[model samples]
Target: MTLSQDISDIAIIGTGPAGLLAGYETNPSLNDSQVDIFTKSSKIGHPEHCSGLISFEGLQRLNVSMPDLKKKIGYNSIRYAKLIAPNNLSFRIDRGTKAMIVLDRPKLDGYFAAKTRKRGCNLHLKCKIHKIGYTKGYWFLLMTNQGKKSVTKSKFLINAEGIHTHLAKSLQLPVPNHKWHFPAFQAVIDGVKDLERDCSELYFGQEFAPGFFGWVIPLNEESARVGVAVGSWTGNNTRKYFYKFLKSHPRLKNRLRKDKIVKTYGGIVPGAGPISRTYHTNYMVIGDAAGQTKATTGGGVNIGGFCGRIAGKYSKKIISNEISSKQGCVDYQKQWRAFFEPNLSLMKFFRRTLSFLPDKDWNKIFQIASTTGLEKNMKVTDIDLHGTGLLNYAFQPKVITKGLKLTPHLLLSYLRGVLPD
Candidate 1:
C-alpha cells in the first residue's frame, strides 16, 4: 500500500530495539497497516553502535526469554570483570555466575524486527521520516526513500532515533544534556590472548583514554570488542585515542592481536540520564533519544527497550481512545521513570563526579580501595539497578565508620556524590 493510502494509528521512527518493541507492544489487532515503523538504515540492526551488554534481569524486565533469544540471536556470557587503574594496579569482581550477556546486536535487532512484523506492525527500512506535525487530532509525517518523498499520518508518534535528536528538537521537546555526552569508538577483533572467556576488562587512565576509560568485552577466548569513550571535554578524537590505547596499554596491547582487527565503528554516548520531559502532545520519545542509557556504562538496550515497551503499550491505548492523549503521555512518563529513574540518576551523579578527577587521583583511589576493601564492596552486583547495590555497600554503617577512620577525605567525596542534586 502507498504511504498516503491509509492513516496509521501509531507511527514510530528508527527500528532499534526500542522502536521495534514499541511496535510489538502496540499490536494493533493484526492490522499491519495500523502501526508503522521507519528507519533510514537499510537493515534493522546495521552499523551497530551499542555494546549489546545487558543483565539477565534487564532482559526479563523487557519480556525477553533468554532461552528463546539464545536459539535465535546467540550471546556470550560474562561472569566477572577486571578493573585496571592508571598505575596498572587492578582488581577483579567475580559474580560466580553469568551476570551479563554480550549479544550479537544486529541479530537481536533483527529478531525483534521480525517479531514486531509478525505482530502486525509495518516495518519500513531505508525510509527516513524527515518531518512531523500534529494537526487537529492527528499527526502527519513527511518522509523520503530512494529520493522519493512520501507523506503519512497517525494518531501518535514514538521517536527512537538513538543519539540523533534533531527531530525531537524540531518538535520542541527537551533533548538530553550535551555536557555529559561522549564520543566512543570500538573494534571487533580476533586472535585475542590471555583473556578469560567469561570476563570483561576495563582499563582506566588518562594517558590512553583521557576523561574516560577503555574496555575489552570478550565475545570468546580469541575474539572481543575493544572500545573507548572519551568525555566531550577531551576534544573530538576518540578514534585517535582508541588506536593509541590499542598500541600502548601495557596489559591490553599484549592481549590483543592488533593486526587481526576485523572491523571498526563509533557512535556518541548520551550519559546525561533522562531529559526533563520525555513526552508532549500526541508524541513520546524512548531509547537513547530520551537518554535512557546507563550513566556509568552507556548501555541502553535494557532500559531503553523497557521504556519502549511502555511507550508501545500506551501508544496503543492512546490510539484506541482507551485513554486521552494527555493522560497517556502522563502515564507513559510516570510509568517508565518510576522504576528506572532513581538508579539512573544516582549513576549519573557518580559518573559526573568521577569524571573530574585526575589520573593521579584515580591511582590513589584504586590504592585506597584495594587496601580498605572498598573495591570488593563496590562490586556491581545488579547490572540493571547497580546504583542501589553500590550505595548499599558504601553507606553501610560499618563501611562508613571505617571510611571515616581510615580516609575521611575520600568518604566526604563519596557522601557528596550521593547527595548531589
Candidate 2:
C-alpha cells in the first residue's frame, strides 16, 4: 500500500468490537466512497481483558448475539449469579434460562471484524495514531507502524478506541469525569473444584477489591475466568491484590490448583459514568473512550455498541448532506445520552456509595439480603446496562425495608441523589 494525502469521509480508530461495528454501520454510500478503520494491534482482539460475560439482550443489540460460537470456542450460558460476602454469606439470583453468556472475547471481536470487512471498509491493522489535529474542515492524524510514519486526513473521526483516550485528549476533546480508575487482574483457571459452570459468582470486600470487587465466570464445567478490580483511590497494585485475594479465600485457594492456571489478563476500566461531551467539531467518540460503560459493573460492550450504531448512522447522514457533520456528531452524542445517562446516574450513585463501605458493611448487607428474600425477588434477566431498574425494588416493602436495614445511609444517599426527599 502507498500513501495518498486524500480526505477520507470518516476514519474509525481502534478495532475493538465497537469500532468494527461502527465501520460496519457506516452507510454503504459513505463507506464505499471513503472510510478507513485502524487498529494498533496486529489482531482484532487480543491481550483480552474482559470477563466476556454479556447479557443475551446485549448480544442481540450488538448484532453479534449468537447462541454459541461458530468454532465452538466453549461458553457457559449463565442463568444464575451467586453474590458472596466476606463472611461467606451468599445469595443466588436465578433467571433459569440463558440470560447471559461467558465467551471468548478474541473470537467475538474477530467475528465482528470479518463482518465489517465484508461491508467494504478499509481496515489498517497494526497502525497507531500518535496525534490528531483539525484544520480546513478535515482531521489530520499522524500515524506510524513498523518505523514507518504517515499522515491521514478525514472529514469526520469516530474514536472507538477501547479504554485509551489519548487520541481524544490530544485532540483537546472532552473526557469523562475522573474519580476512580478500576484496574483489573484476571486468571483463566481450569480444573476448578466445586464450581458450577452455569452459576457465576461475585465477591465483595474492601481488602479484596476496594471500590469494585472480584468475579468468577465459568466458561465450562471445569474452567472459568476469575479476576479482581480495585478503584483508583487505591494504588495500582492490582496483581498484588489479586494474588492476596486468591490466597485468602478458602474456596478460591482450593479450587484454583497451582498447576491448573491457564492464563492471565490485565486491563483498566474507567468508571464514573460517560463523559459530558463526546462530540467536538467533526469528532464522535464511542465505546470506552466515551465512558459509555455501566458504572455498576464497569462493562461497556452493549451500551457502546448501541451508541456506535447511532454515530455510524448519523455520520452517513452527514456524508449524504442530509445533516451537517457537526450536527451529526451532536446528534450522535444526544441519542446515546438520552437512553444511557439516567441509567448511568443510577449505577454511579450505587457505585459511589458502595466504594466507601468497609468490609464489615458488606457482611451486614449480605446478611440482610439472605434474610429478606431479596435474592428470590431478583429476576434472572437483571442486566447491568440499566442500573436504574434495580431501584424498582424500592417499591417492594420487604425489599426496601431490608435494604434500609442493611444501610440506611446508602438509602439516604440514593434519595439525596435520585429522590431528593
Candidate 3:
C-alpha cells in the first residue's frame, strides 16, 4: 500500500466529537499542513446512541456551534430527585442551577464533522485503521476498506476511537479498568404529553437501576429519550432493564402504551477517568477511549472536547519543536489530569460510597440534597480543578461529615480495587 501525500502532521482515528474537535483546534495555515481523520463508518452519525444532553457552557467551551434541530426544552432546575426504595420510600434532592440543552445526536455529530472539514481537515469515511507504529519519529498507519488497503504516516497519532480504542489498547496504553465500566441503554419515544417541559427525570435505587440510575430526558414536547444505566457491579444487562423498567414502572407503563418507539440503542460508558496515563511517546487518547466521561453522570461531550482541544494544541507544539521533548506529550496528559482528575477522583469516591449505602441512607442523603436544592449541588459536583474555592466552600461540610462516615469502607474498597467477578 502506498502512503497518501495529504496525510499531514496529525493522523486522528475516529471522526466523533473528539477527533473533529482536535481537527478544529489545529492551526490551519501551518505551512499548508493536512490533518487527516479516518473513520470506519461510511456515514457520520449513522448509529447514534447518545442522549446528547449538555450544558450551554459545554458547547461554548468546545467552540462548536449548535444546529437548528436543537429544541429548547427550557432550563432544567432539579428541585428534587428521588431514589425510590423497593418499599416505596423516596429519597429526594433539591439542587439549584439547571442542567441545560438536550441535543439531537446526529445533528450534533454532523455539525462537528462539517466544522472540522471546513477547517481543512481531510475526513476519510469507511477507513478502518488496522495497525499503527512509530518509525524514525513518524507514525505509520495501515488502513483497509472494501478489500483495498492504504498507508499513511504522520508525526503524531490521536486515538479518539470512542470506547473501542483498538489502536491505543494494542499499544498497551492504560485503558480504563473494565471494573469501572457501566452499560447504558437508550430509546427514543414519541406521543407523550404532560411531560415536564424543562425537567429531566432520574430514578436511582437498587430496584430500578441497581448500580447506576435511570433517566428520561425530554427532547421536545412530544418525544423523549428514556434510558437506564447499570453499573458493572450489578451484573445486570442494561438493555434488559430498559424494557423491564418501562414494563414495571406504573407511570411509564401508560406512557409506553401510548408512545411509539422511534429508536433503540445501547453502549458502554466508562464511569471513571483515565487510568493514570493517556499519552505515550507519540500517541494520545481522548473521549471514551480515555475514560473521560463523568463517573456520576455518564456525560463526556464536554470533557472529550476539552481534551481534544488540548491534544490538538499539544500536537502542534510537538510537531513544531516549540517544546522539543517527549514530555511535551506527557504535558498534554498533565493538562487533562490537572483539570479533570480531582473531580473524577472525588466522584469515584462518591460512586463507591453511594453504591454501598442501604436504602435508608440513600434516602437520608437524597432528603438532605432535596432540601439543599439539587441544582446548587450539581453546580458544586460539576466543579473542575480550574474553578474556584467553591468546591471547598460548597462541599466541605458534606464531605467532612457524610464523606468521613463512609471513609473506612471506601478506603478498603479503593485499596482492594475489587469489582464483581
Candidate 4:
C-alpha cells in the first residue's frame, strides 16, 4: 500500500458532483489518500450555471437527502411546469409527486465536496491539469498549481471536467457534436410579477431560442432564474437572444421589471446523448465531459452523477485488484448505460423530433394535446425518467386516436422525423 508522494491510485479531473461522487463511492476499498480530485476553480462550488432543478428521487439514489441539503443549504420545492408553444399556446404539466426541488447549486457542489472529503478523498483546488499522457499503464498529468507547474501520475483517471471536452478529445474519445451543443445564459432577478413558486415555465420559439428554449425557474415569490439556450446553427448571439426574450416575449416580458438583475451565469450545454465511448484501459469519462445529460432538458447533474457513482464503485474493484482496470472500465461503461441509456436515448429522439417540427406544427400539436387530454394524461411519475413517461402517454388509445384524427399531417411529420434517428 506504500506509494510515492506524486502518485495516486486514481486521479479525478474536476470537482463537480460527478467527480466528487466518483470519489465518495470508492468507500472502504480505497483510502482517501489514494484518490485525488483536482479542480481549476479555487473553491468547491463557484460560477454556478445550472438552473438546479433536480428530482428528489434522483438525488436520493445518489445518497443525497433533501433534509441534509436544506439544513446545510436551502432549496425550493416545485411540482409543476408550463410548456409554452411558439405561437403562445401553453399547457400545464402537474408532477403529482414529491419529486422535484430547486437546489442552491453552488452549495450543492460544496456539499458533495464535503462528503467526498469526509470519506478520505483528497481535494486539490486551483490545480488545473493542462496536459495529460498515458505511458506504461499509468496516466501522467501535467498540472499548474497556484502558478507553479508539476506532474502527477495515477493508475486510473476520471474525467468530470464538464462541457469542455478538451481532455476527452485529447484522449481520442469521440466528443459530442458541436452543432448539438447550445450556448445557454441565465440571470437571477427580483421584482418578478405573478411568480409561481411551485411552477417552472418553458418557452419554445426560434426567434427567441432557436433549436432550444427559454425557461423561468422561480426561486421564490419575488425572484426567479430566467434563461435561454440557443443552437449554434442559428448564427445568433445567445446573449442577444436572451435580451430579446427578456424584453419582447409576449408573456414573459410583462412579468419582469427593468434593471432587477441579481446575478447571471452562462455555459454550453450538451444536447447529444452519452458519447460513443466513455472508457479505456485505465480511464473513464463521466458527467458533462461524457455528455451524460438529458437532451430534452439540458440537465446533467443527476444523469452524470449516476454515471460517476458507477465509475466510483468500479474504481474499488480496479484498485483492490478484484478486477483488471480494463474490465473495470468496461463494466463501468456497461453499468451506466444500463442505468440511464434507455431514457437518455429516448430523450435524444424526442429532442430531434422537436427540432424538426415547425412553429405551426407545434401550435397544432399543442392544440391536439389540449383537446385530446394528452397533457392531462402526462402524469410524470419521475422527472428524470421523462422518456418512459412520455412513451406511456403517447401510446394511449385515446391519444393515438385523437392524433390521427386531428393532426394526421403532424403524425406523418413525426414518422418522417423518426427516419433520421
TM-score of each: 0.92, 0.92, 0.85, 0.93
Worst 10 residues of 2 by lDDT: 412-421
What digit string (tens of lDDT, one per residue) describes model 1 on residues 146-177? 67898888878899988878889888789887
Write candidate 3's Cα lDDT for 96-187 as tens digits: 44436677766777877887888788888989999988889888889896568988888888899987767877777788766667788988
Question: Candidate 2 has which clashing residue pairs, if any?
Answer: 95-380
Error of 1 at 143 (Å): 1.2
- Residue 189 in candidate 4 has what lDDT? 88
lDDT of 4: 0.83
Q: What value does the lDDT take at residue 50 in candidate 1?
A: 70
**What does the lDDT come to for candidate 1?**
0.82
- What C-alpha lDDT do the candidate models reach, one value each? 0.82, 0.79, 0.71, 0.83
Cα lDDT of model 2 by residue, 204-315, tens digit: 8887888788998898888888899997758769998888877777568877765777998899866767787888888889988888888778877778877888888888
Better of 3 and 4 by TM-score: 4
**Residue ranges of candidate 4 with Cα displaced over 4 Å:** 1-4, 28-33, 401-421
Candidate 4: TM-score?
A: 0.93
Clashing pairs for predicted structure model 4, backbone only: 32-120
